[model samples]
Target: MSEKVVLHYFNGRGKMESIRWLLAAAGVEFKEEFLTKREHYVKLLDDGALMFQQVPLVEIDGMQLVQSRAIMNYIAGKYNLYGKDLKERALIDMYTEGIIDLLDIIMLWTIETPENKQKQLSNIEQKAKERFLPVFEKGLANSDFLVGNQLSRADVHLLEATLTLQEIFPTILSTFPKIQAFQERMKALPRISKFLQPGSARKPPTDEVYVKTVKEVFSHIFK
Candidate 1:
């Protein structure tokens, strides 16, 4: 049976990009339905009779799947990307959740209003970088990949999550060289390298610019 995967994403990379990468990795044929803004995405849902409030929802066959990581987990399970061993699968979840936490902190700065943006940055700086980066840095040092040495879904999610840093916390990763190198290493993977090519899709302008400015401010304060 042929499976159809429709990925609802914005212009640039975000949650959906990792799912895109997973589909590519699994050699799955899917359509990329890029939306412009939150409104455009909402309209698509309305037109398609989609019940989800978010973009990055995947429609497989006749069923709709909401949430980016949920899509990733579903596809990964189908493709056996979760690893062969139970312990390895648990480790994959460990790394993927860690990346998700990092994303939440980073998004707080990007999604907040300009007047209160700095305050959000300060909170992420005080809490995330100081508290979490070290632990993640140690994890990266423990293994070449996030979970196992093999390319699991955890590495794929981590790679996609780290890309956000270039626009969200560039300097934070600079302080933790291991994580920085891990980002580079993931990009070097042949499958991931495909997405790193110039002119690859990007996140929306609002998110891109806001995250870039937040990273700049955080760099100065953290340094």
Candidate 2:
């Protein structure tokens, strides 16, 4: 009895990528179905195919799930990707949740208007990034993995977030050496390395300048 899992994704980078990587790394069998903005979701909603009316949904053995994080947690628990002990599992959640907070800020910035974007950078985002770095840096410094001594689902989630952010928000990781190293290590994982292959069709950042600048900053920090 093989389980069935289907991922609902849109064009470009978003929560779908993390789910994709986690499932792929675990060697899980699933289908990737993409939806466009115009009428795709409408059709799903009309037919009740997308139970939650949201994307990145994973259907497992006739059960449908929505919400990106919850889907990842479900996959992690299903595949034994959660931490070894209670404490390690908690740590994994802690670090993974912390990274989520950072990504949230970046996502908000991604959709902001130019004037308000600068305002966000200064008034909210700038301070927020500085605050989160120490926590992520310390987490990486504390152990080889975020939740356990070995690789866990939390690492896959956060590592993908970091990679996406390095291209989308480079300034945030500019001074964070531990996180830089962490990203490098996670990317080098055999399972994870497969994601880096060309022709992924992952969406590019709306701002190329920001992407280039951040890549340069990453190089500087790693150097």
lDDT of 1 by residue, 1-223 (tens): 1267777665445566667778766667777665644455547656774565555678886778887777788898988789878899998887788877877667555656778887776687666567667776888887777667777887776666666665655666778888888877877777667666765443332465544543443343435
Give TM-scores for every candidate, taking all chains together and pairing residue i with residue i: 0.75, 0.78
Model 2 earns a TM-score of: 0.78
lDDT of each: 0.69, 0.68
All candidates: CA RMSD (Å): 7.2, 8.7
Q: Model 2 clash pairs?
A: none
**Model 2 lDDT at residue 14:** 61
Model 2, 1-223: lDDT tens per residue? Answer: 2266776665545666667777877877676666644365666678676656666666776777888888888888778888877887787787778767776777667656678877776644455456766677777787777655788877787776777666645676877788888888987877667666775434455464543433343343435
Lowest lDDT 10-residue stretch of candidate 1: 213-222
Off by over 4 Å in 2: 1-4, 123-125, 169-174, 201-203, 206-223
